[model samples]
Target: MIISKPNINKSRINICRENSQSLEDIQNQSSSSQNQTPIIDLTKAPELNYKYGRTSEIATLKQWILENHTRLITIYGLSGIGKTALTLKLISEITTQFDYIIYRSLDNLPKLITVKNELKQFLCQSLSKPLPEILDYFKSSRCLVIMDDLENIFQFGNFAGQYLTEYKDYSKFFQQIANSYHQSCVILISWEKPADIETLQSENQHTKTLHLQGLGEDAKAIFQEKDLKDDEKWEELITLYQGHPGWLNIITLAIKELFNGQVYQCLIDEDEVFLGDIEALLENHLERLSELEYHVINWLAR
Candidate 1:
């Protein structure tokens, strides 16, 4: 079982750059746009960046990205459903097939305005090119790129960057990035699949979309391997939480400690799941949904 690092300082960030910055790159940005883009300030939430118990989602997306001609593949699901973790796992797993894999989490990028710069920085590292020339040079090469947790560039709140206006949309830049080369893959992981992404699907065979469902039998086994109290109790809990790996991992970890590794007694106590990580994830997507939709998700999960 892998235990991820806890988050340090998170801000309620609204980025003013033309590109989205990764969590690690938070300090590097000049202008913060907290006043713009309504998504709940994820910068202030805890870091929910662990990858756990979503092997099938990772494998399926991996297969489509590697086998299909499409350069950009989007993985969509509800909030806290492990979209980012799936993409992170794929980047680590698929590196062998490509030159190298580069990942950029759209965790804090509230709008499409910041995609170009974020992606450009990511592309340079993944493709091993100069940052200034990444997009132009990507006309030929093989690389796997992932942008996680992206929302609409068109209709959602205030615009943030010049890239939105310059590139028409992030998808077009990504479309070219993925389609320009013969053997390259670009993946987008989002809470909800945007219509622009759906419409931009390749007419012949260039783009693919993978919708992430909750954990299955294999995933359940993985959950058991992690920190949860017992097979039976954890199984019941998953029924309530929809088998989201990240949330379940934290739940299991908390349960394991509460039982002091006794497993059975933790089951007896029937403690509610932990809220820090799940709350952070919810906060990340809170701006994109209504207040009722937001409350019901985490409230019912308990």
Candidate 2:
């Protein structure tokens, strides 16, 4: 018996070759042709009861990330000055542009290496991937990583931006994110600029820093929200609280309860704003002051 090879056209031969591939390989090829579903993890984000008045800051942040593809950014401000609120607002606006959005808070003081490993696992499906591989993955997909309360990694009572020794890896991680070729960006929200970040970062390198200030005229919204009376004294009340949303919220509560929502009367009746929980917030800031700062406070007290 003579076995003869069947005639096969080039197109049929190609189809036969494609059919020889394993199911897993075929599945991978099909999946690679399709865009991955975006992974958004914002569980750590804080819920805001009041609408933020950070219009300009939010606009600038959007421009930096979406328009410029800025890789590293720092948003520094006094505690309770609306840094977190502004960041959350910005994230909400730009979430559609990224393939993955992750928000992490350093407030609990997690190790930087631990954070890096977790981020790696989240991005690459395995924490064992090398840094270069992870960065390549970032290049292929847009990721937005937000680290809030970065000051938690710093040592207090020293110069500004001094990272705790154990957390130094964070600086290196940020440097890589800034200098390497990646399509992702990281936003750090802190009380002061991190020391290494301030040293190596430059605006031309897709690295930007924003120093957030009081809301100024925007503070009026807070007053309006609380329905406090005395529209004429709104500026005075805002100035007294230094336009700090946290402080203004505290004062509004006081005026609502003690003066029947009469803001002007509250101001006239009390020479000084009753701090309530604001005192604790101020004390936390005071504890981070340097020796000369303490001396100035002592001299002023005298």
- The number of the candidate with the highest TM-score is 2
Q: What is candidate 2's CA lDDT for residue 43?
A: 54
TM-scores of the models, in the given order?
Answer: 0.59, 0.81
What would the per-residue lDDT of candidate 2 be over residues 1-302, giving only the tens digit for each residue? 12121222210001111122221232233234344344555556665544757788888999899889999999998898888878766755655566667778998999876787777766764235555555776787788889999999898887788889898888877888888888999999999888887666653468889999888888998878889898999998888888888888888888898889998787785656667788999889889878988788889967
Residue 220 shift from truth in candidate 2, angstroms: 1.2
Write down the worst ten-residue block by lDDT for model 1.
Answer: 35-44
Estimate candidate 2's RMSD in Å.
Answer: 13.5
Stretches > 4 Å off in candidate 1: 1-55, 108-136, 152-168, 175-182, 202-204, 219-230, 254-287, 290-302
Against the true structure, whose lDDT is highest?
A: 2
In angstroms, the error of model 2 at 255 is 1.0
